[model samples]
Target: MPKLLVTAFDDEFCDEVVKVLGSKGIHIHGGNRVVSIDGNSQVDSVSLENGSKIQADMVLVSIGAKPASDLARQPGLRIVENGSIWVDEYMRTNAEDVFAVGDCAVKRDFFTRKAAPVWLASTATAEARNAGTNIYGIRVLHQIQGTISAFSTQIGGVAFASTGMTCRACQKEGFRYVTATAVAPDRHPGMLPGASELKVKLVFADRSGIILGGQVSGGFSAGELINMIALAIQKKVTVRELDMLQIATHPLLTSAPTVHPVINAAHQALAKLRAVGRELPPVKKAA
Candidate 1:
């Protein structure tokens, strides 16, 4: 068993490695952003940000990547601090027709109207498809949608997932978001042998009543649960929709849909919004 030392701490990619590494029953010692290894024989101690050090048998350094923008930047195209090729709404860069995509471009989010990193395969493909179709003739999709920043991982037989912004992120971004958190036993009755504990937190914009993001911790339910939250977020679903959702649940398979953790969390957030006197607007439903 090679004692793997992980040093990748970038909020973006670190989670990917964490999810994969968790499968091997390997030990991880580092905090969210820091890892220290002292017994591995293959790789030596690796230095990183904040003067932190880790001794590892093997070191996997995952300094987040810079967008491959040298090609565009060489010709006087602008580059973001993170090295992404800057582009306009139509995916047009400073240099016309030289469209950049994948890990090489800056993508603006529709909801926040801010430029965030585009690491999602779906985002890249969507951008590429729009660019390809509009390159020659017709005008089409011109913007990327709200970046929910969804990710998930399986650790020690239990899965974890998150979407939208974390509590820290939302506060830092200054979003007027309300949150509802609920922890319950998965598979209904608490005493069932396979029943597992699940925690769900749903955050929504106070003024718009749109689901801002969600986080889930639990067993098999976590994987799909987060997806549901992500969709609600993507479609700007409101607490009302969640309250009115017709879901399928069972004693052995899931909790009653009427009081599911996800839906319950939305209800929870609504209370917070009302407590703060923020008006809850009607949330748009998906067609």
Candidate 2:
């Protein structure tokens, strides 16, 4: 097999990624820039700003995307500083009867309310639902306020997923936060066929214990588990509440009830808070 190198500017969750990929002989280069790709008629090698050269068969670039707001600009629609068509929570644009959604529309961070450059088909579908219902008038009372940035991908036979604010993002936004992690087999019995080690890491506000974000890695179950975490974040579920969340478990399908990674992770966070002598407020009863 050919050696592979993945490069990135930041180390957001790269430790976890490296742990997974490194076991499979893949290399990660964080905090480095690709100075140049040395190639002739066909690709040859790549050079990095850190004075490193990597022989490569091919190079795949994933530098993210930008909004193609030219069409909206021609119509005189308001454009935000990030180059997306400005839209309200209901997906309504500044111009009357104009609505924009998806990649072409501006998005704000769910917690920070700052411009976020997240563009995903799932996000677009949610926006489309809001826009379609509200275009005739505000029929939908609940609307998307900001992008949660939920993402999931499979690599080297392992699934990885994350959503909402990461630890780095929280730090950058000046949020005091706590993080906890739990790991267990996906199936109740470690010896069960198809069982894989599922790991869950959750971040919460240090003071309120409200879930900020979560990441999951393991088997196929990680994909759906992260979605559940995303919903918990959207609902502002606190560690105390999440620790006591009710969930169903099966020997063949999920982790043991006593060791469910999500609940266990929340429990771990709660313990960390208590260890620090932080008094936690009672979980509010849902109205």
Candidate 3:
């Protein structure tokens, strides 16, 4: 394959993708946009706004879908400027007793409390469950206030996963944040067969130590590892708590006990927190 362009809202994740793809001899063009096509009858090459061109035999454009709010509009339901059906924390629509979920419903970010354009089946199902449980009357199942935007994907034998807010999102949303990264072998011993390198990055609120987001890239286990980080974010786990986290590690299943990437990343953030004299107590050494 020729050089390709991959765009993402998370700058760190985008760079990680570039690094992984680059190692496989795949060239990547970051932060560029296709301005025009070179061929008249077909796309022989594509020109980017940066004055670089990519030769290609095929061009695939994956544009996002907008919510079909026209029908909902006829019933006097409210719509956001982006045309998605507006809904409350419980997925309730503007009209009396009306509920909306899934891709068509507008979403907000969990920490930033800003409108989120993310769309995913998992998120939709979560919203559906919240709405379904609360339709008749409010219950103990808490109403969902915003979307965490947890997601994962794999490329070139590496699984990439992320959740909550990226550094870009934090900056754009005007949150003070700090970030740290750690690298480790995915197996107990690096010499083990199928052992792959794992990299974990975490972002936290600068003052409070609350986890803002996390990114992981590594072996197939990365798909599930990031989910655990996502759950921590949902439960409001801080960097201090993550540094003290306990987990089962096996020679065939996980990283070495001394160098787990997630805990080490939290340790990195904890060091920074201590430097600033934050109130977070240092986490006890992991066993």
TM-score winner among the candidates?
A: 2
TM-score of each: 0.74, 0.91, 0.88
Q: Give a tens-digit lDDT track for model 3, residues 106-199.
A: 9988876677887899899998899888899777354575888888889887788888777876877788988899999999888899999988
RMSD of 3: 3.7
Model 2 misplaced regions, further than 4 Å: 1-13, 23-25
How many clashing pairs per prediction, in order? 4, 0, 0
**Candidate 2 C-alpha lDDT tens digits along 88-140:** 88999999999998999988989989988888899999999999998898987
lDDT by residue (tens digit), candidate 1, 133-192: 778764776445535566676666666677776655577778877777887888767788
By lDDT: ranked, best first: 2, 3, 1
Worst 10 residues of 3 by lDDT: 1-10
Task: Output the TM-score of candidate 2.
Answer: 0.91
Which model scores highest in lDDT?
2
Q: Is candidate 1 or candidate 2 better by TM-score?
A: 2
Q: All models: lDDT?
A: 0.68, 0.85, 0.83
On a 0 to 100 scale, what is the lDDT of residue 273 in model 3? 83
| lDDT-better candidate, 1 vs 2 | 2
Worst 10 residues of 1 by lDDT: 1-10
